[model samples]
Target: MGQFLQSFIFVLIVIILGCSKHATAAQFKGYEVKSSSTAEFNESVVRFIESQKEFLILFSKHSAFYRFPKKQSIDIQIRDFLEARSKTAVKVRVKYNPMTAEIQKIEDLKN
Candidate 1:
């Protein structure tokens, strides 16, 4: 009986770990933006924005303002639209907290 109980507990632990891994995998499936333009800002934020261009375009077109939560010192949001060349054109607006010098929000303008 004791061996059976031990085996059951081990199985429970394995199941818990497996579920946690799945949760993390799901979390990582979301899109992130990364900026490629020469605009000077925090490199990390730029990278993030540039990476998620598809989401950014949708966000800019639909939402009046898109915000990056206060997680790091430099948070940047990129606003993008199409140009005459059919290329993606982007403008970056930044908001920073004076006390912390951290970027709080970024807004992209509509064409």
Candidate 2:
């Protein structure tokens, strides 16, 4: 009986962990770039910090990558792009605010 209860609890824990999404909702209380031209760049990410969410990529197997991980909010589109590209490393062009250094847009670049 003890062993069976333990197994059931373990399964429940696994299920809960597996179904969980982001531990917390992304909240950033800063200005938005609704009408800015913003700067664009193609760069790679050498590291990822889960505490902050945002991106623009180019990361070939090169050692020279961009410095990053600012605590900013990312839109749904950017989040989706990152999730889709999670399986493979690819290059991307990012439109970002130079003043705030917040990524506003991101798109995959053609090789």
Candidate 3:
């Protein structure tokens, strides 16, 4: 009886742990964006689609590609940054509005 009880508890624990992991993966299945737009896109792994002057298209493993309108200030900064890392395909942090997908800021990926 005691052995059976122990085995039951162990199985219960394993089941609980398994369920939690599945939940986490599902919850964060897509994008898994972090806070702030600058924080959201950058939190994953940012890559550009075209890096056009008029707009920016970026996505990561955990996110969907979304177009964002760019301002002159951000355009120059992003263009220059992408130029440098374009070949290298470096990971970067990005922040934007999840609701509008509008970019707010772009920064170098923190080491």
Candidate 4:
């Protein structure tokens, strides 16, 4: 009886931990880009935008990539482009995780 109880408790703990982990992962914030415009698309911005578009189309079709976590924040994207240009002389630092089809993060040191 004691052995059975221990096994049951172990199973319950595993179930609880699994559920909490899944719930936390599900709660991660995501952003969707609404529009891409020429006004914001300079040379560096253009490259970054193209890469992002390709990532979205070829990789993360369902998930939306955001410049920021906020509802309407494109500043982070723009800043990332500018920073990449300054350091690498080209738009870089854009990362795509093919497995997840998600842009893990975007950042710019320029601002």
What is the lDDT of every predicted structure here? 0.35, 0.48, 0.53, 0.38
Q: What's the residue-level lDDT of 27 in candidate 2?
A: 22
Q: Which stretches of model 4 miss by more than 4 angstroms?
A: 30-111
Clashing pairs in 3: 31-62, 37-95, 37-96, 38-94, 38-95, 38-96, 39-95, 42-93, 42-94
Choose 3 or 4, whichever is better by lDDT: 3
TM-score of 4: 0.30
How many Å off is the CA of 60 in candidate 2?
8.4
- Native-referenced Cα lDDT, model 4: 0.38
**RMSD list, candidates in order:** 14.0, 7.8, 15.0, 14.9
* TM-score-superior candidate, 1 or 4: 4
The sequence of per-residue lDDT tens digits that candidate 2 reaches over residues 67-111 is 233343544434444554554555566556666655564455652
Please state the error at residue 16 of candidate 1 in Å: 0.7
What TM-score does each of the candidates earn?
0.28, 0.39, 0.44, 0.30
Compute the lDDT of residue 51 as modeled in candidate 4: 47
Cα lDDT tens digits, model 3, 38-100, are: 435554335565544345555556555555455564444445555544455655555667766
lDDT of 1 by residue, 1-111 (tens): 999999999999999987865444323212233433322232112222323322222223222222333222222212211111113234444444433333344433321
Instruction: State the TM-score for model 2.
Output: 0.39
Give the Å error, residue 82, model 1. Answer: 29
Q: Better model by TM-score, 1 or 2?
A: 2
Top TM-score hit:
3
